[model samples]
Target: MRPNPDAQSPGPCEAAPARKGGERPSRRLLLGLLGSTGMLAALPAAGQAPTSAPKASFGYADVVERARQLGERPFDADAARIPESLSQLSYDSYREIRLRRDKAFWRDGGSDFRLLPFHLGFLHDKPVQLHSVANGVALPIPFTTALFEYGKVPVPKGLSPSLGFAGFAVTTTLNHPTVQDEVISFLGASYFRLIGRGQRYGLSARSLALDIGGAYPEEFPFMRALWLEEPAPDATELVIYALLDSPSVAGAYRYVVRPGPTTHVDVTATIVPRKVIERIGIAPLTSMFQAGEGDLAQRSDFRPEIHDSDGLMMQAGSGEWIWRPLRNPRSLRIASFVDENPRGFGLMQRDRDFGNYQDLEAHYHARPGYWVEPQGEWGKGRIELIEIPTDNEAFDNIGACWTPEAPLPVGEASEFRYSLSALSTTGPLHPYAQTQHSFAGSDLEDGHAQGQGSKRFIVDFAGGDLAYHLGDPARVELAVSVTAGSVMTRILQPNPAAGGFRAIVDASLPDGQTGEMRIFLRARGRTLSETWTSSWTAPAAAAPPQPSE
Candidate 1:
């Protein structure tokens, strides 16, 4: 299934060169340069002048009703048909087809923020219903070429009006007084992503996930209609309403977005499946983890580490915490943590070392770390982690969600609600310390493979005042367990560089089989660290070298 476009920053790849009237190439041309961009399709537009949307009384119940109605039928989205002139241009040309800043909704004299629509073309051919709320009723926001400057778009001789906007973004002063940062964006499917101040965008959150990562493949749900609610004249918050549609499920999403250094949004959703679903992933966060602490020595990148998030940080019902280091393994892997009324979980970006990613433009280090905090009891379920092995970072191969122990049956309905906050470092409780690093190498001495079926593992812990107690390194104890492997030498040592300690262990498995292992560190006889667990899988045996016979 196609990724929810809202979460990913599709490179300004559609960036076209300067054209006549300062217009750039069209989305069609630029997308062709990158790849064939997919669109949901659109209907014919009515010939008319653009108009403002009327106000409508809307609330939570309206949201549920929207989902319920869509669930009763099949989801069919029509891609927008643009005038041929715009379609023929390159990415830059299409971008040059700008929406006149002067035409911004409520820009003249209404509020500090104004509504600016997106141009059609490229992956945005799908026409989405955009509405504005004012007074008492909600009215449709009509479309017309009058709202935009063709630039070099070469508007066709006769084109229809009501060719609605592609999608929209909210721009506000994030840093400088006059600088408007594109904070929250709703484009592409039932997906939308946001970024906080001082953070670059990475990863996305979806309206709903239907049978994700399944053998039967997955179904992507797209948002059909959006209601942009202009906040109270003095309000700093922004509100949006979205209707999500797909073959399996239909849903509604209400987002109240507040942007800051730790941009946060309160998401409330109601999904009604047209049919029963085998799996419904809720409060899900999608990210990429190429390689990190646990297996850094195993990665091929020049940097010491590369990932959007480091590990799964769990604050359990019993008040204990757990941290599972992320792994980019040989195949798709899913890890689950079952609990009753979970506190919260998210795909995090813990390692923020700019040196980790040397590239200047794609500041992977500045990517935001998102956290999901359940507003109420979620019952028994698993915090599932699905890792799809990749040799690159272009794809988001890491997925973490709450897979309910209970599945919503076909033709049946269920409701789940939670709040997710996109955080840089504010979400998680400042734990006394964290496992800073982990290393794995041959168990043999002199760096040669001497011990058959043997490997040595090193783990480091840093943060807080753990180093001040250096005189009591011997007093530190470690609880390491090998659930299904054989162990030999284990040592707890100190690393002066990171101001932390390390847990070194050696293990052997019969026939090079795979198993699960768990380890933890304790200081001054108190359980000092979260449990560090890993699942090891045997690599597929390589083909025996073919000999000329």
Candidate 2:
């Protein structure tokens, strides 16, 4: 489903500071700055032509050297310099500023990709330097208001022509040969969003995550600069290099973006820590989950399910596939799955039925899921999932990433490489059966006594060899295990409607305790489905009825 072009909501990251009169910028406003031919026809080209090239040749190694040098110096918290007028603009005023399509970089160069720069204002106070690299020569793209059409926004006086840009978006002939559709964007801090054919914006990917879900305050790293390599007229891929900076670390990144049915981004990241970093997240993915099948009773909304992602999928180094359903927890919750030489992990939106989410404007079903496949051996790390409490769907409260066991050494560069794919289906990747749906509630309706602190769960397993065993349902068995609870009962039954098998389990846990439950299907000692894992917290027994009242 394509998202409404004018919808207003917070992005996948933290909400930006409120604008004047307490209004905030919408996610659409932040990610949807596409250029229009009608608006550009009357505007003139802005900024000066390319300046003289730098003395040395430009390449990925150059960006690494720059990052290393940057780590040696004190971190600059004031690098982004914006005039008060631009910084103080309201959300409505900021949305009025649009880039001119006729003046877009590489528009007349016969290249398949056109780069549009974002104007700095509102929540995007940080300015990132952009450069066009061609023939080993990197030329800086200067900033100018002449490239923008300020609708009703008043032009600020004495604006600097060297103020630089907030970030940029790349457009190509993705859906049609004559029309350009925005395939990717890099804006805000180190956050970026991508879409494939017939997909809409949903989650976001970050360059690096520091001290996330730790005791201390989390540190956000920003992209200080980007070098876009000029693409060949017939090029099928676009290469980009980025410099990342934060108080704890400085890093360099290279992205090879290929747009197709499933857009894939090949990423190479190298970081040098200024100090010993205890917690660092690699290939971090951020998303939103307000409510889903498991928590339908908790939601009062009209839509059945409203979320960008429904579950977390992982392939551990030990060749075990796991699926953990996401939730909007009552409090902050962090779950870790340890592994070595991990294969892949991602946040997936498996429920594609539009009826599940009746909101046509949001198009939650069309949101793409991103899978991270590690390129080489990443020894001794764990995939961490952090779910925060949120009452509204506007805020992003889901985060997943890989955290290494050892702290990064000071002043030493650490390198990691991975491929991220924005896809919709997981059948091609998973060999075993997968979890189709899951629900948890009390077991009263099943005639089982409402035992104190007991909860019942129903999990459906589909696909894979489950179809072959449908004729003989007695051969399948349900395996259940728990970390801090006791399984009272377990039953496996054939689900002819779904061409799968359903497992029902009743478990008991101590009051106020949280436990992890793992379930799977097996036949003749052969595992048939991915492990379904979930965390359940038993509600504390109600205060003894307050007899005095």
Best by lDDT: 2
For candidate 2, the 10 contiguous residues with the lowest summed lDDT are 1-10
lDDT of 1 by residue, 1-549 (tens): 334333223321112244557864432343222211121111123233236533257665676786787788765544434555544555455545654553456544344555556656644555567876555456567766666666655654555455566677666666555765567766655556678878766776766776766655666666667887765656677878877777788888888888776678888877787876777788766776777755655576576666667777777666666677788876677676788888877767777778877747557788777778777777887787777776655556777777778776555556666666667763246455577766666444432232235567777877655687566777778778886656677888876677777888876654346766777777766776666677664333446799898
Clashes of each: 30, 0
- Candidate 2 global lDDT: 0.81
* lDDT, candidate 2, 281-349, per-residue tens: 999988889889878765757889978999999999999999999988878889999999999999998
Q: Estimate each model's TM-score.
A: 0.82, 0.92
Q: Best by TM-score, which number?
A: 2
Full-model lDDT for every candidate: 0.64, 0.81
Clashing residue pairs found in predicted model 2: none
